[model samples]
Target: MRMHRIGAAMAAFATFAVFTLATAGAALADTAVKFALDWKFEGPSAPYFVAIDKGYYKAEGLDVTVDTGPGSVAGIGRVAAGTYPLGFFDINSLVKFRDQNPDKAVKAVLMVYDRPPFAIVTVARTGIAKPKDLEGRILGAPAPDGAYAQWKAFVKENGIDAAKVTIENVGFPVREPMLANGDVDAITGFSFSSYFNLQLRGVKPEDIKVMLMADYGLVLYGNAIMVNPEFAAANPEVVARFVRATIKGMQDTVKDPDSAIDSVMKRNETADRATELARLKMAIRDNIATPWVMANGFGAVDPARLAASIDQIAVTYEFTNRPKPEDVFTAEYLPAAADRMLK
Candidate 1:
């Protein structure tokens, strides 16, 4: 009887030890992924922060660390260099990069800014109302700005003489201030960014004239989730999980943008909730939630539209080598269309 009792106790002890180890292993198995964001902690970046704060990333077993980036276009290099496995950037920049450096190119998985906020903002007081108005005027653009990168295309599309406009290389910090002070006749920036910043600086909303490039036939995609092909190829399942988690975060953001801004505030102590909330709402109405996104789905693009954008880009971006459609983006990592429905 004594021997039997000892044997039973040992068996129970072994089972408990095995269970504990198994649980620990599962907890430790989360894949760590580094994501390079287009800019600092801002309202538009709330969804990503929402993912991390709400445990959506953890639900996908992804330990995603979101890092602040210099600009929308620079995140491409960061991902291609393998410093970050994934990043958010303008798809137009990706197309150009794929043409320039085929071997080190990145591909987009999720389209975040479907409406493409590329725009030229000017106050009505400057007498700049149309794309043609930009000619013979002083224009400020940050060298690394996504809107500025497409200036050639904008100039060509609207039949404006590039030589007629005085181009000033304004720092990001001074792009709006220069325009606000009448130093520059116009500036290239994201539609919402320019509008809100100008408003905060005492410019009347009615005086702000925003020319969204997409409304004028740019037809380009804005920022998207891109990945280093090598990293994606090695961990296809992990990539899929990340997309799923991001979709959940985006859905939540659409439901409550203010809450999403809260997540960003936790990361950036100086972020004003009211201002960020306004920015977040504008992004959702203008860029993220759109008629196309509603009719089709989020995170996916119409192939025909993407093809035409590549051709438009070719008009101004003299590529050393032509980039193929598949090289710039792929829908392989996107969740199902049903899963992406924001409504």
Candidate 2:
């Protein structure tokens, strides 16, 4: 009996030692990841803030820091240079990068906003009813890439002479005022944001005309989460967990948009509460809850849709060097939470 007691004690000690070592190893493996956002903290990126506020990243055993950068291209470039482990950017811009440097390996792991939000917003009094009306009108454009390319494609596809429309790089902040003061007859606006800002400024829905790019067959993916190809290959488990947590965040935002708005507002130091709230609500309704996103599962990308976008890019922008559709994005990392919700 004495011998058996001594053996049992030894076994218990060994088990405890093993358990402690395993726990320590896991703690050590939990790494910190830095994420760069393509733009300032706003509605479009509320889900990321929601995830952070709700401790989603912590739950995944990750220490995440989300920072805003100058633009999408800069964000992607930093990630490629290993300065940022992850980033959120325009899908079209990523494609442009691949076209410019085929040797640089990068891939978008998940698409946050499934639909493109680019639109042409004109005051109701302007009577710019269709794409054709854009002719001879001064229009505000963001820049010479990504959405601008799509805008130019829309003009050409519709038989509107690009020269007839004067393009000005008005930047995102001044787009609304430019239209209001008649500095530009129309401006490129995110369907959700510009619509809400105009309403808050006393422009009624009926008094405004919006030409959505998606309606003109310019259905491209925007605001995708991308990773370095090496990182993705070596740390798929970490990538998978991050994607899962992000999808859960998006679902939570959709279910309670008002609360999500508050969560996002808390992260913005210089954010105007009224304007941000309006933009958040509008983005949820017009951009997030659209048929395309609803049918395919939020943040889900269909290969066919991606192929169409790639084809459009090649034809429209002379991007003969674009990456193959399969290399651009992968749906494997998208959370099963969206699937569970579908049921």
Candidate 3:
């Protein structure tokens, strides 16, 4: 009877050990990723939250933690400095960074905004109806804003005297408010963001004029998922998984924006759901799901256009060393073409 009881006890211990190992194996399915965004929890950023809420990242074996950033430039710097392995930021700034730091350059993985959202927003009543009108007008922007970063490129190509245009360095939170209160004639901001934000502040849509720099001549690609090349080189599979998961999230967001907005509001309870929803739809229609993105699919760059833009960017930016399209973007880790098409 003693020997039989001892055998039973041994069996129980074996079962418990098996259960513990199995639980740990399940936990090891995905590696955690620290993802930083170019800005706060807002409409344009809602899709990433949707990805998290929808379990797309988990499905791809990525434990992604999405954190909001102060600005696009800051996001780029964070990723480049290795504070975060991945981030969403303005690709143009990456160009500048690559010029300055050749060896430690970050590469854009997923191209979110095919048509750059860089725009100069103004009140129509201010008589700043055209690019030329920006001359002699007080324009506002956060010093590190992506739109402001491209202001030189825009004003240069459009034949505007940038020097004559008075620039007021405003904080991101107060940019639209300052414009609405007549503190500044116009502001450099993302077209989708400042347009709706100004509208919510009682500035009529008709009163607002959004001159997208892309509409004028800036062939620059907008914000994208940037990875520290060192991280990407060491963990190629993780990078691919991250891109694949992001694709799922973006496509899901396109299909049902309301759900994406829900995910966004969850992260930021203070967000005005309706306002952010509207802002999101605008970004989808005008930037994310643009004609080019629709035809060519997402998560890939048009090499010719990228090359042309690099040359065009050189026209405005004095690069310490001119970087090529391949230096800034790569389509290698993009999943099979079918997985990339955004409906």
Alpha-carbon lDDT, every model = 0.89, 0.78, 0.87
Off by over 4 Å in 2: 1-29, 171-173, 193-207, 337-343
| Cα lDDT tens digits for candidate 1, 81-161 | 888989998898899998888888589999999978999999978888789988789999988788888888888889999
Give residue 111's lDDT in candidate 3 (0 to 100). 95
Q: In candidate 2, what residue range of length 10 has the lowest lDDT sum?
A: 334-343
Task: Give candidate 1 regions above 4 Å deviation.
Answer: 1-24
> Tens digits of per-residue lDDT for model 3 on 1-343?
9999999999999999999899989878789899999888898887788888888888888889998886777667789888899999888888888998898779998999998888999997798878998888899989877788777778878999988999989998999999999999999998988998898899998899999888998888888999998899899999999898888888988889987899888888998888889889989987898888888788788889888888777766797788888899998889888878875
* Candidate 2 lDDT, 1-343, residue by residue in tens: 9999999999999999999999998877757888898878887778888888898877898777889887755688887877887898778878878888788778898887677777888997778998899898898887843556687568756888888899999877777877877788888867766777677667777887878787776768777899987787888888888887777777788887778877777878687777776677667766666776777676668788899888777756777686888778887777764452433
For model 3, what is the alpha-carbon lDDT of residue 96? 84
TM-score of 1: 0.92
**Clash counts for the predictions, in order:** 0, 0, 0
All candidates: CA RMSD in angstroms? 2.4, 4.1, 2.6
Score every model by TM-score: 0.92, 0.85, 0.91
